[model samples]
Target: MSDNKLWEGSTPFKEKSHLFKYRNWLADNRNIYFNSYEEIWQWSVDNIGDFWESLWDYFNIIAHSPYKSVLETTTMPDFKWFDGARLNYSEHIFRHAQLEQSAIIFGNEQGDYSELSWKDLKKKVASMATYLKSIGVTKGDCVVAFLPNVPEATISFLAVNAIGAIWSSTSPDFGTESVIDRFAQIKPKVFITVDGYFYNGKPHDKTTVANNIASALPTLEKVIVLPYLKKEDVSGFPKDFIDIHTIFKTDGGELVFEPVDFNHPIWVLYSSGTTGLPKAIVHSHGGILLEHLKYMAFHNDVHKGEHYFWYTTTGWMMWNFLQSALLMGATIVLYDGSPTYPDFYKLWAFSENVKINHFGTSAPFLVASMKNKIAPKNNCNLSSIRSISSTGAPLPYEAFEYVYKNIKSDVWLCSMAGGTDVCTAFVGGTPFYAVYPSEIQCRALGVSLYAYNDDGQPVVDDLGEMVIDKPMPSMPIYFWNDPNKERYKASYFEHFPGKWRHGDFIKINSKTNGLVIYGRSDATLNRHGIRIGTSEIYRSINKIDTIEDSLIVNLELEGGNHYMPLFVKMKPTYKLTDTVKNQINGLLKKEYSPRHVPDEIIEVTDIPYTISGKKMEAPVKKILLKMPIEKSINIDSMKNPESIDFFLQFAKQI
Candidate 1:
């Protein structure tokens, strides 16, 4: 293996360290038992017990009833990990609650900074927990929250989980219907939300939606409103609603923490459910905590006291991932509002001021930034940033080059891909390997990730369904309402029983051995009996200099003729001129199969996207088919919903 191409012409940095840091232990010890990736995987399969047991030790995972056995693996599907482990997920995080250390460093697009010390954060969390307990919130109960990416949101979740209460959240943008579809199923007893939030210089109201959700969901007993934007008297708040300030009353005692099993439920996240109603994927505390700690420590090289930030909302999984930094004793930078609002260098300015260590964001935002011509070179000092991780879409290889050339010469551009299903990524960053553009470094160390063919046999260097042959700690214990595991099993296991079939169509690169997530397997377009990933088209389309960003979906015509339909959102200052459109078409026809040439290249002001920032190609495809989008369709969180009309018009023209 060569290290020269790893950084892609970047400056030399210490790729490996001998120091026995808790996070670097995995990298340090991999060579002891295995010489290569193959050996490491084989050893993991052969000695499943020793593998996870060593992982627990290496990561310094705190637990009670120390697992006498790492795993009892009779088969892959029915595999059990860390049997008989008891620990409080909150305890591991609360260890960093030293009075002097900074726990949260918050900023906004409007140039404001708010800092929360460990003592202050713990006190606030204790206060919130006290309030939750006063409202009869108990262990095993669900607490739903809709908030922005602010300190309050993170603290609220930690407080809820600190008491062994399940925490579920969505961004404030989600409508009442979308919120109800999810929280109602779980029957959450307490609802924590904000009065409103700020985005793109506009104030968005959540008071009505929060009130509606509280009323519709009979299981919801109370609503705690934390005023953010509008601080007027919330007299219109439902009778069931209570002010967060009221919870701050001194009628509180010392914070009480609850211990839970390894597999105890921590959160109930949801899938987009554009095809149907969203599936509530329940993730456990032990798995999420351990997985996050491993990735943050080893992969991102995050150190205690380092400033960590991810541009995301509570609706996205990364928001929860960001909260784990507290466990690692890192300061979290929570910025609410548009990443590029008011100015293009908003995020870069934040980084310069805060000295951010590891920064995470989505690919679509990067693409938009590139198209918008918002270069951070002139006005921002981004020298503090070490790792820049991108997920939520298949990052265009060109985007990687752009970041290196424009953002910083020496930076680890980690292109990660995972979903709300498992609460973490199956293919992401690893410090041991060098990176290639738009390529995930490797399948997670213990994940057993493989691209399976139609026959279900694993294949390499070819596009196939991304499957995991073994169960890892992060596998969801079950769904929210599903008691028999029917819904849970059917989601991932039905396609490949006992094996995790992550619906991604990806190819492990032959030359670099890095993984390329082409797109969703379900979104794969089959023409003339050949299956092609949507990202294949997106990769080529995004390469065109004139094109800003585009969404490609397989559109079935009235006569059952299906063709690739692409809708492009041009740069704010640039329009979809005829020459640009012609160039886009010519490139698609020449580079890919003629079928790949979209039947129509329609121009729209914006493309719809989920809260996580992935293009809403599925819903756009649905609307093109003339299907009525139910209110249950949570397009509320989408960056742009008006673009769906453009896509529909283009479908009709085709």
Candidate 2:
């Protein structure tokens, strides 16, 4: 609870922040007042219906039909939000089409740049929507995309959602099996994909792969291909395949918004399918719309016409979340290629060129920059960057220090943790709160987030399972193919009966109102009846220059014995030695407790991770615990599937 503050929120910033404006509006209109963010958060969670209702009025949400009630309270998994209302998520995006700034600033690893004006974006979206309707796509029909982080992908998603069709996408980098595993389950009517994509200065031709995926989905009625790699060649594609460019041939004039039920599915986001085929999570049009408006205005503090960018691919939830910036009248910047293609400073340079106000990337990227000693402030003009947000993993204390000491002096560093489950962060930053190292700024308003002990009781200032006591508007309405809602209930609700168990270990600092996320609870290490977070072990390992990546797991043996092992992927030209193992163990013991030290230190060539950048900890633990390889991990879900070969062999010995 000691205040070794990294950055304190200044009065000047608070005065100019969106949250402050909203607070003033509330005070002036509703006669409601609050002295601090904590007080407002308390009021929001305690009166969930009133809090959400206030947001609808505050944002002036455009609903085609009036809702009978704000919230229809039911059991956990069946809670209804804004029933009897109809809205279009895509309609809110084009409300700012008349802005002077371009709607999208796009770049890639190849150093090519492009911009799409609001007028052009709207025209293209309308054309695509018209084309889809012409081909018989309608409300409630599923449309899936196999593309990268490009303007076309954005346009396709908007077009699909505009017609009230459910949308989902996978990055071209995903394996064909992985892509099919997700899209096939949704029974998509239209498959939109890129023929090829560029990454790390290399062109990956996915034309045949796209065709293969198209063939795999028996339910697909149409295929739309953008010939990004070779537009001139038509021989490799099917004669029936529709060219994406042809959609704009007739110039569909006016865009239309299809009004649907408030809780109707807008898109299906898949869970990281490490153990099985991923769960296709369906989120509603109204739910995402309301949640995005609140989070963008209150948490991120992004302003209109300001450039917003997040390093993400079509597969990740961040890609879907990034489009919400348009709802706030912000110009969203999209990058199609690698973040570290030409160099580690690729994104920073892009941010500078685009004048990005809110820069978003994963914690691994920042940690890599810190480890490689690349100072963006020295290499590029980063004056336009206001806030640098990190997700995907916890930003360790050292990474926080590295950003301040090397990247920028006065920049706001915010660390957040949410998952594909909500498509938004439960804990994010607020302009009214001070920044701290190794901790998130605050729990998002209206989110009743808490750390629950083993007995299903909420605990403050202690490591426990992260849970949500109240319903969130953005929570998945249901998982696709989850008939009778059994899969859905088992996924989140069954663990705690009525509350949503978010599968992560977190500790809420009662004094600071900050959150410290450990690694996944399923991958937590237990020794002598004490549970330890893998992040704590990794924080110690990150201090040593020898280790490049690591994974720790605790196995419960047959005879009441516990086997905890640390698997380290060493840096190039470095090997794991006893001296290095001792360094890891000694540092962990000194920094934490003896339980933090692993029983064995082993070297591995690589650590498996999901395509979304999350380490495959639980899957790897399952393998090491003598579970069947096929049942323990799904190879298609891995970023590097072959990397598990070493672990598979190692599992046999254990």
Candidate 3:
């Protein structure tokens, strides 16, 4: 790796960080001291139970009852954490209600802005909770929302948790079938929705979509509609529909947090549903409370009263994660429209206007901005921004360099990788470490992350499966409707037997202790007998200005023949000429090996992505491998469902 340090934590900056204070707390309270992050991380993973148990006191988590053991079990599919402790996730969120900063600040594509103060937020949550209970919803009941990334969604989630009902949501941009595939499985008692939303300067009316979704779920008792769109009313909705304004119209209810067991389900996050019905991964209230507190407080180094913003829809896990900043008394910022609404620089202008301290976005957005040459530093006052967080995919080396060169010189850039399996990131950033190009700063404390080879041996400086030998509280309590958790076991445990084999292929650098993610192991481009990550090929492809996006898949045909083709989406003005193809091949061969070059390079209109902005390489591979179309991918879960049609027609030729 290059010896380039983009940013360094100074003496004062480190001293003021929450991680520094936590380190000091360990020295005083637990008699634990370490000079380096590696030492602290080692101690944490070595003593996983003690490390997590210490967070109970450090975060001062409010528990109605005390826990007996740090962890009750030690193995997969049966592991238990903090047995017998009773707490509430919503309760911890309200602890910061007394802060002077606004609890939620929202902006939309129509240039509309609004703020919800802590006092107002508490009142609305109480009102919504009262409405929920009035409709016979109670502890363990499910409440789902078809809403955007607005304050109302936050209010609805808090209210559901306030009364002990489970919460799930999808951004209204999702198709009706996609929403039904998720919400119908949960059998929600209350369905919350918005009439519509504005995106890219256009109005998307989902009133009909909401009614269709509500009608499909026979279990839904009440439908609550928020009249968000100026053009539409709830006139077309089904009967028993209640306006959200009515709930707030009679607002005299008191906010109450219902304490549940340590491992009780608080929210259900879904798998991409690329293949089948999305797996409803359930997280415990206490588990999420601990994980979020640790991640936001220590890893993010967020301070109270600071503005924290992540551009996301309610559908993505990052939306759930964004709200956790409020647990640290930071003002959480929300944006509802497309990131590139009038222009690519829309979010940067919003950052200037809102004075965002911590800016969070996907790696693709940063890469696209770099490609478009949209310089934020030239147009906006980004001096208030301290850290820029990127995830959703591996941040390329060039993208990391572009941020330091174009955005700001001294900003803390964090490149993290995690998935819906666990809402919190296994590997992310820490204040104790210096910023490294194209490397995740460190494995999160207590994550017990390791890269193991095909023989299940942990390897340093070599690529392997990302396995977790120990359990984190944040790991899913159980998947909804997964009998005996068979699907869950088959998803994570079947590969490594007691260890969780996260699908990603990653390597931990022996010298820097930094991790570099290659790509998903399931989608590895196995060239003949030599295996390499698709990212290794994409790394060279991204450098070619002609290619906008690409996907590579290896098809194992009969007689052990391998056909790996690279499908690239060209820029509007460029065509896939012979020179462009040769440029792509020459770079891949030069950068990696000749094996990195694809057998064929083809052009496509667009590449398919999950609704949450992930490359759909595995699903596309199945389609081209002659799997039945319906079983191959759930089209509703795709960002561009039409993009899959090109592969379906090509499948017959194969």
Per-residue alpha-carbon lDDT of model 3 for 169-287, expressed as tens digits?
Answer: 99998999999999988899999999998988888888889889999999988889998985446787766788898897677477888889999898999999999999999999888
Higher TM-score: candidate 1 or 3?
3
Candidate 2 residues lying further than 4 Å off, grouped into runs, are none
RMSD of 1: 3.1
Candidate 3 structure lDDT: 0.90
Between the candidate structures 1 and 2, which one is better when assessed by lDDT?
A: 2
Give the per-residue lDDT of model 1 (tens digit) for 1-654: 122353742223433321124234555665453344445555665565566666677767777677655667736445566768877777788887778778999987655679989887778788898888877999889999888888878778888988899999998888777778778888899888887878888888877877777788888777788877776577758666777767655445666678787778999998876556678888878878777776676556677888888898888888888888776788988898888788777888888988998888888878767766667866788988888988888887777777877787778888888888877788887655677776787766567788999999888878799998777778887877788888877788888878888889988876666888889887787765678888778878776666767777776566767766677877667788789878887887787778787776778777777756677766777676666666324555455656566665654654
Residue-level lDDT for 118 in candidate 3: 95
- Clashes (candidate 2): 0
- lDDT of all predictions, in order shown? 0.76, 0.90, 0.90
What does candidate 2's lDDT look like per residue over 382-466, in tens digits?
A: 9998888899998888899899888888988878889899999999999888887898999999999899999999999889999
**In terms of TM-score, how similar is model 1 to the real structure?**
0.92
Model 2: weakest 10-residue lDDT segment is: 227-236
Report backbone clashes per prediction: 0, 0, 0
Distance from true location, Cα of 53 in model 1, Å: 1.9
